[model samples]
Target: MIELENLSYTYGGGELLSDVSLRLQPGSFHFLTGPSGAGKTTILKLCYGALLPTTGRLSVFKQDIARLDRDQLALMRRRIGVVHQDCQFLDHMTLAENVALPLTVSGQIDTAQREDLSELLSWVGLGTRLDSHPPELSGGERQRAALARAVILSPDVVLADEPTGNVDWEMSQRLLRLLVELNKMGKTVLIATHDMSLIRAAKSQVQARVLRISQRQVQLAGADL
Candidate 1:
């Protein structure tokens, strides 16, 4: 779980986020929406310990992020999976190797884990693409593969930033369903996106709290959403 208390983040002498408070509970689903440059990505970074609050407090799993040392922060990050907006991958690595990077880095990769890796890729509809490289994948394939990579470690929380930004409506819905499935499995989910239609589509399938960023603050969206 992640909690932010009266948090503010300043960059380049400007305050991008101010007085934002949020608590991500276990098994919860949330959608963060706002226009471009609204600090949606900034908030996700704070939640996963990628960036510390410039003022106020941020805690991941009950420990203040500002107080954690490097090693501790690294260990804490393993509990939070993130799907970046860019869907970055090593061009030289195979899909299976890319998805298994987390396990490899954490010293958890082995024969049994490789079998599980195949299952994970299969879950993302990439079972047959394991031998392919990043350049060989289509847009939707890359997004789904990114999701697979993010959850490969079985993180307690999953944060995705504009996950469907590059895909078509059908593929977007597919990714949404995959995320919904993860929520059903009891993983905490927070997705930052500008797509209102996607958020609307998710509401019927799952109970999701829509949080909108406006004027440097975060507030729960009303029924209009």
Candidate 2:
């Protein structure tokens, strides 16, 4: 549902990404891998309209990002969920309130949504931690809570950046399985990570396309991965 054609992003007089083209189809799963500073996060930002391309075209759900107005862009973003590398939560809010922020902002919070919120937290294994504050959560718990919040709207696409970076292997696998389950439910999934083992582990359970960024270009990773 997201496509980038010959896209390039420049920052501070240098190009971070150059002539990159990729499409995320419905129900597709993709892993974006590269060295640090290779613009993996930039690609994710471009996909979700957080940053516009310096050159070329980016379309989300068939609408050109450059042509969209501020309100239109805001509306379009609701259909795409993002799990940032740093899972930031309001320290003053309860986990439930934090996860339910989107619904509250959209004026969609109600009894049924509250029920769904509980189920979502439970799905992320945070059902019993509803009243806990962000500072009380561990790294893995924070990541899972972030995922729960990202998908709380049941968005059509989910983009995650280094989601398992701070967790242990077991917790990483747990997060991977949660993401895999989301893919099975037909949500488009794109993850940018440096963890090769995690990508290898996902191969058996999901058909994933691994894309590598090298020398300012995007290429499909070789079988060695």
Candidate 3:
């Protein structure tokens, strides 16, 4: 559903990424692994149309992102859910509100689907914390809440950057399970993480291809783990 053709991005005499090309097919799951400053996050941003490439083309859901206007890009993103390494939430809103913000922003609200939101929160183990503020929750709880929010709109593709960066091993595994389940249900999943152990854990549960950002490009990662 996402394709990058000879994509390259440069800034202030530095090349964050170059000659990167890949295709993320529908229902495919991928783990992006790289060291710090290796452009893992940059790639995720490109996939979701956050930053336009300095050269080459990026297509999502068959639309060329390079030619889209701001409004068009915003509409395009509605089909792709993104989870950042640092969760973004309104400090004043309750966890439930935060999770439902996507629906609000999309100008979509079905009173009958209120139960769907509750069920999502419950799936992420945040049902009891629905009324809790962002600051009141633990790091893992916040991460799970972010995941719930990203998928609330039922995006066709999901992109997560460092999703388990702050969670414990058990929590990481739990989060992985949720992601795998999403893939099973036919959503495309792409995650950028530096944690090899987490990759290994996921490899055991699902058929996930690994991609690595190296030498200023993204390529299919070799079986090094």
Candidate 4:
């Protein structure tokens, strides 16, 4: 659903990404691995239309990203859910309200769809925490809450960065299971993480492809993992 051709991004006289080219097929799951400053997150931004490339081309869902205007980009983004490394939440708002923000902003909220909202929170293991504020949540709780919010719109694709970074092993596994479930439901999933152990754990449970960003270049990881 996403393709990049000879894409590059430069900032402050240094190249963050260079000649990166790849195609993410619909219904595929990918894990992006890289050291700090290797440009994994930058690449993610390009895919989601958050940052335009300094050079070359990027296409999302068949639309040329470079040519899309603000409204067009917003429309494309609505079809893709993104979970950031930091769970960006309004500390004053309840968890349910946070998860419902996408719908609210899109003018797509359905008051009659209360059951659906509750079911999503429950799916991410956050049902009881729905009334709680962001500050009250544990690290894992916050991550899951973020995931719940991302998928509440039933997006066609999900892009997650360091999704299990702060969670314990068990909680990480739980979060991974939820992501796996989403993949089973046919969502294209791309995750950026530094955790090799998490990638290994995921291998046995799903058909996930691994991509490593090293030396400013992107390549498919080997079976040597």
On residues 20-104, what C-alpha lDDT tens digit does candidate 3 reach at each position? 8999999999999899989988899988888889999899999999889999999888888899888999999988889998888
Q: For residues 37-96, could you state the per-residue lDDT of candidate 2 as single tens digits?
A: 999999999988889999999999999999999889888888888898789899999999
lDDT (Cα, tens digit) per residue for candidate 1, span 1-225: 789999999999999999999999999999999999999999999988888899999989999999999999999989888999789999999999999988888998888776787889999899899889999999999999999999988899999999999999999999999999999999999999999999989978899999999999999998633
Candidate 3 global TM-score: 0.96
Assess every candidate by TM-score.
0.97, 0.97, 0.96, 0.97
Worst 10 residues of 4 by lDDT: 110-119
Best of the two (1, 2) by TM-score: 1
lDDT of 4 at 164: 93
lDDT over C-alpha atoms for residue 18 of model 3: 87
Taking all chains together, the TM-score of candidate 4 against the true structure is: 0.97
Candidate 3 lDDT score at position 62: 94
lDDT of 4 by residue, 1-225 (tens): 899999999999999889999999989899999998899889888989989999998989889999999999998998999998888999999988899989988998877766777888999888787789999999999999999989988899999999998899999999999998999999999999999999999988899999999889899999633
Candidate 2 clash pair list: none
Q: Between candidates 2 and 4, which one is better according to lDDT?
A: 2
